[model samples]
Target: MAECLAIRSALSSALDLGIQFLSLKTDCQVLAKAISSKRTVVEVHGVISDIFFCISQLKGFTCSFILRAANVEVDTLAKAALASYLVIF
Candidate 1:
């Protein structure tokens, strides 16, 4: 669920900024697969729907899953934000 929200927020920002192309990277394999398949479990169907809608609006979009070690910087930042109870994009 957190992964879904984060991706949605990023996509929303890109749309707001008039970005025509986007490459999204995630360390969560399930989330990446869900997005690629355009399907979500019942618990997060709404959020996934929103993500799909955003993808439809984009001229080009790519969502990829990377190993945790490959995304250490973002992983650290996310942890820091959680520790501080802050929202990050």
Candidate 2:
């Protein structure tokens, strides 16, 4: 979740620098569903709520849910990170 927030903030900052159209893609089904629903964010992720709200400000952005097989890079990286985290602590 923290990583998602950081990426969203960076993307927003980039978009601020004269972007015409932007589309966000995420493998997280929950996040994609939540944003597409255009409903208020729940308090569960209160710390990251601001970042989610910031996503609403982007123009022509669409959030999508992709299957694991279709998201090899992200899925691989997530698993690698999980493995590394476990190894570290």
- How well is each residue in 9-73 modelled by candidate 1, as lDDT tens digits? 77899999999899989898988888888787687899889999999999999889999989988
Choose the strongest candidate by lDDT. Answer: 1
Residue 46 Cα positional deviation in candidate 1, in Å, after optimal superposition: 1.4
Candidate 2 per-residue lDDT, tens place, 1-89, comes to 53355445555676678664566566777767766775544643653465566665666666678876787777666566556556777
TM-score of 1: 0.80
Give lDDT per model, in order.
0.81, 0.61
**Quick one: best TM-score, which candidate?**
1
Single out the weakest 10-residue window by summed lDDT for candidate 2.
1-10
Q: How displaced is residue 57 in candidate 1, in Å? A: 0.5
Give the Cα error of residue 34 in candidate 2, in Å: 0.5
